[model samples]
Target: MSEEDTALKAIEQVVAAVQRTQREKDAEGFLALFHPDALWTTAHGKVLIGFDAIADFTRSVLPGASWDGEVTYDVVHTQFLRPDVAAVKVRQLYTDAEGRPESEGAPLYVMTRGGDGRWLLTACQNTQVRAA
Candidate 1:
């Protein structure tokens, strides 16, 4: 595969991981996808710095979130800043038991390729998509 293809593939895997963990409500699995010093801003605008804060928040919310539905994440776009860094935009949808949309989020992730050739989310911001 070409370099672009490889990078895209790697990024897709990261996106898949995010969706998988969210659907499973597995906080640890989701936390593992982020870098140790990553920064994340929640949909509500709260900032979390480092893996510890992220893990704390994820563990608190993932298991007890009111919505019991399928969480789907779609990668809307990706732009490479360099061979090892990418900015990814994702659309997240939560469907209710009846498969109707419950809520939506638009998240942007800055991912960096580690020395191990794995993409780790380095910075992220999640925004709630509210109807105007």
Candidate 2:
């Protein structure tokens, strides 16, 4: 495969892991996707400035999150900012326990390729799609 294709595949893998981790409520696994200095803004407007802060939040909330449904992350678009950086847009869906859609989100992830060649979530914003 070409270089760009390989990168895209790697990015998709990261996103898939996100879906899996969120579904399983595995906070550690979810944290594994981030860069040490990553920045994150949640749909509810909470901003997490670094991995430590993010970890604290995830550990405290994920396990007990009622969710009441399944969550999914689908990569809708990806833009390569450089050979090692990418801007990825994801469609986040929350479904009822019976699989009915409940809510949706638009998340933008700025990922960077680490020195070890793994893609890391460097910066991100998760925005809820509110109905007008």
Report every candidate's CA lDDT.
0.93, 0.95
Report clash pairs, candidate 2: none
Candidate 2 residue 26 C-alpha distance from true site, Å: 0.4
Output the lDDT of residue 11, model 1.
95
Task: Write the residue-wise lDDT of candidate 2 on 13-90 in tens digits.
Answer: 999999998888899999999999999999999999999999999999988877788899999999999999999999
TM-score attained by model 1? 0.95
RMSD to native for every prediction?
1.0, 0.9
Name the 10 consecutive residues with the lowest summed lDDT in model 2. 61-70
Task: Judging by TM-score against the true structure, name the best candidate.
Answer: 2
Taking all chains together, the TM-score of candidate 2 against the true structure is 0.96
43-85, model 1: which lDDT tens digit per residue?
9999999999999999999887667668889999999999999
> For candidate 1, which ten residues in a row score worst on lDDT?
62-71
